[model samples]
Target: MSLLSTVRNPHDLKKLTAEDLPALAAEIRDFLIHAVARTGGHLGPNLGAVELTLAIHRVFDSPHDRILWDTGHQSYVHKILTGRADDFVNLRQRGGLSGYPSQAESPHDIIENSHASTALSYADGLARAYALRGESRSVVAVVGDGALTGGMCWEAMNNIAAADRPVIIIVNDNGRSYAPTIGGLADHLASLRLAPEYEQVLDVVKQVLGRTPLVGPPLYDALHGIKRGIKDVIQPQGMFEDLGLKYVGPVDGHDVHALETALRRARDFGGPVIVHCVTRKGFGYPAAEQDDADCFHAVGVIDPSTGKPTAAGGGTSWTSVFADEIVQIGHERPDVVTLTAAMLQPVGLKKFASTFPDRVFDVGIAEQHAVTSAAGLALGGIKPVVCVYATFLNRAFDQVLMDVALHRLPVTFVLDRAGVTGEDGPSHNGMWDMSFLQLVPGLSLAAPRDATTLRAQLREAVAITDGPSVVRFSKGKINADIPAIDRVGTVDVIYRSPEVTPTREVLLVAVGAMAATCLQVAERVASHGIGITVVDPRWVKPLDPVLVDLARAHSLVVTVEDNGRVGGVGSTLAQLLRDADVDVPLRDFGIPQTFLDQGKRDQVMADIGLSAQELARRIVELAASRAPALTTGEAEEETPAGQR
Candidate 1:
């Protein structure tokens, strides 16, 4: 059997000799490539962290000695060493292994936020808790160098230094978060890597002092002052040292023995200490190593040999549609500029950057700065388009509310992955954007139904010069367009059933990607002799006045969306109907207020009863109970065509 096959847990890993570790690292890398290629996960990060993770597991007794992973993308190797190797086949699928660290998976795992720059704060809290209990356990926080760019890392570090507790801070400096890490911290880390080896010089000085005569004790004390001066001249460890935390090497992260040695010293230091280890983001695989952008950070199912996707490409995604339209907008409007939070390529801002390099800014993993800075740009008479994932925007909620909306800046936010994004699990899903953004005053939110609507609505959003405007779309391929049969003000009528003698209209308000599903539900309901009128409200927020009038003409009204049920567009519109005194029985169909599991988007929707079949059944039941005679010819005639 392979050396890795024997490693059922950390205890089994400890059984291997030092000479066996290099082979084990090789075996683990090989296993990860094939496993992740099949499962489609954070492959590059895990590949880079094989030796570092092995060293960590070897040095720290996890569950007893807490080891936290920042962002959790680099935890696959940790999972393997902690007896989760058998669960790789079902990674990121429903009821399978999570792509990020999960506390339920094993005792070894902790801090499963998956958000960046949070492990250090969690480590500080854990360290304090351990100290209060008079426990002897250690706390090790493995944070990526990219996470250091976030303001939270510095906040935690300031407290950690003041506490002076036994906390081992391992800086996994691969120098990338989605893309190459930006700002002064990245530059400082690069300088640290280039600095002379200080540990070797310190060892030479110690030996020289030991070999001296009776003056050795006095000379050693005097040499300590000189050593500091020498360190200032050679290595730049002063930044961390000045913070009241001990600093260690720019050690080679791929060398398991060296990493283990560095970690051992940090573990024994009895105070906050940082061990700097330099690694390549995609260390093992040739295809990943050569990747310039993000180093293949996350990928779908691919061929192991070529590292190419196995499946053929689908229709143009919502991201690409936005990408193409934004470039055209940049060409047309000189005042239009773009901004992203370290995700230029992921959110389809690369073409915009390439065309207008001066106009585009990548503000590195700092969402708060991105939003507030966009507001500043707007104040200077520039229209800044802030493109970011809907989930990550939660980090800058305060900035969006107070800095942008309160100031009434003409900032446009392009939210990609705005609905039930399934594969990355509950934390990564963009399901909460509608509900959260609803609370922000002076903010108008739009959910486009297809590629055409996304392009048109995006233009409309940018045209608003008074307050902030948001245009959001879901993750996968853009749905086929549902052509409008008629237009009533801003609302697009996607489907209108044949006019019967007695019109019993059920207004189906479809939100964004749910338009197609609502159409299917309309067709199914129409078969039961109930006339269905499906309308796609391109702008979900700031309920269109035309919709209230349309609802009054209909017998029953139903709204379908991919966001959470509470406080969403449906709920807001229901309030509008109540205040307008329209006595239409309304039913809201959306994702329930619960943490959804990871799966394919379609499967997750079906599982949550968001499918057309389920929706049609529910609508039928509600109509029967509310007005049984409406489905028959006994209902009142619909309003005149000219009046509507």
Candidate 2:
């Protein structure tokens, strides 16, 4: 049996000999590559964090010690140490191991928010609570150097230093969050890594100060006062020490012993201290290390031997559609600029950045900065297209509202992965964008049903110079073009059952990516002798005026979307129907108002009854219930198929 197999938990890990850990680290990496290759998860981050995680587990007793992870995707190694090694087979699947820290999973795990730059604030609050309760346990926050680019990290650091709490802030400097971390902070950290000898020089200076007779302790105190100045002379920046927090070495993060020693010394210091540990993003795996695009940060099922994706690539994705069109737009409009919050490739901005390097701006992990800066770019007569994941865009809501919407800036916000993004779990789902953005007055939101509409709508969003515009799309392949049989003003009539003749029993309103499912539902219902008219409202927000008339002509109006039912496009349309005094019974089918678990996207949709078969059954039931009301009224002549 391997050393890793013998160690089930941190207690077991503590029993391992010094020489046994190297073999254990190797076992852990081997296990991760195979397991994650089968399961498809955040493989690269976990692989890089093996030694650092082991060091943390060996030096500190968890649960009682309150070890927190920022952007918890890198917690796979931590999970393995906490007796979850057996759970790898079902990782990120339903009822299996989560991709991130789960409070319900174990006492060793806490703070399940998978978002970035939040660990420092959480540590500050936990430390304060422990201090008040007279608890002597230590609080450690393992934050990535990438997370430090966020403004909230700085906010927490300011308060942490002022409070003078015993919090250990481990800076996991792998220098990435989806891509090479951008901005001045990344440059500063590089400088720190280059000056590894400074740690030894500082130790000698401290020893010399201690030996001096009368001025020994006083000079040591005075040396502490001038440490920032001394750091500036030797290093490019002294920002950390300037904040009144003790700074430690850029230690070898791959060296478990060195990390443990640095952590132990920081833990012994009864004040806030930062331990900078440098490691590679994909340490052992040559394939992952050589991957320039995000270092394979998040990956799908792959061949372990070659590290290439095993699964066949699907058709042109919504991202690819945007990626191609945006490049064309860049060529047509030289004033157009693009911005990404550290995700240059994931959000489909890599080609755009490469074609127009001068026009692209990667603002690190700071989404809020990305938005406000886009607003500034718009004010400067440059059209800024901010490409970001839908879930991460939630972090910049305040900035989007005030900086862009309030000023009615002409910035275009492209939200990729805009709904029910499964496997990464609840925090990763892009289900809340439509509901939240509805409240923004001047923001016009578009959800395209196919690649054709995606290209058309993207151009429409960019042309609007008077106010902000948003284009949101899902994670997977773009659906085949659902040909518009006819047009009802701005709405595209996708499917109309020929069997029902003149009278339409149901008006199916499909929102964005839900068009294919709605069409399938329409076909299923048509078998039951119910006539359906399915339309895709290319622009969902500010309900197209023609929908009020379309809803009145049908017996039942069924709205379908991939977003949550509450405050979604369906809910908004229902309200509009009521305001227009249309008596048609409205039925909304969408994701329930609750947190969804990790699973295949199709499985989650089926589990939640968002499938075509399920929706067709519901629509038939709803139409049957309204039969009594329809019978009470006089029969009217059915209009011709396209006449309406």
Scanning candidate 1 in windows of ten residues, the lowest lDDT window is: 635-644
Model 1 accuracy (lDDT, Cα): 0.87
Scored by lDDT, model 2 comes in at: 0.88
- TM-score for all predictions? 0.95, 0.95
Please identify model 1 stretches exceeding 4 Å from their true place.
197-200, 209-221, 500-503, 627-644
Per-residue lDDT of model 2, residues 1-644, tens digit only: 77888988899999998889999999999999999999899988888899999999999998789999987998999999999999999999988899999998999998895889999999999999999999998999999838888888999999999877899999999988888999899999988888855777677777877787778677768877566555776775578877888888788999989899999999999999999999899889999999998787988999988899998998789999999999999999999999998889999998998899999999988999999999999999999999999999899999999999999999999999988888989998898899899989888999999999999999999999988999999998889888899998999999988777335489999999999888899999998888889999999877898999998888888888888777888878878887898877776767777888889898888887788888888677767666543421122233111011
TM-score, predicted candidate 2 vs. hidden true structure? 0.95
* Whole-model Cα lDDT of every candidate shown, in order: 0.87, 0.88
For residues 286-330, write the lDDT of model 1, one tens digit per residue. Answer: 989998878889989999888899999987999999999999999
State which candidate has the highest lDDT. Answer: 2
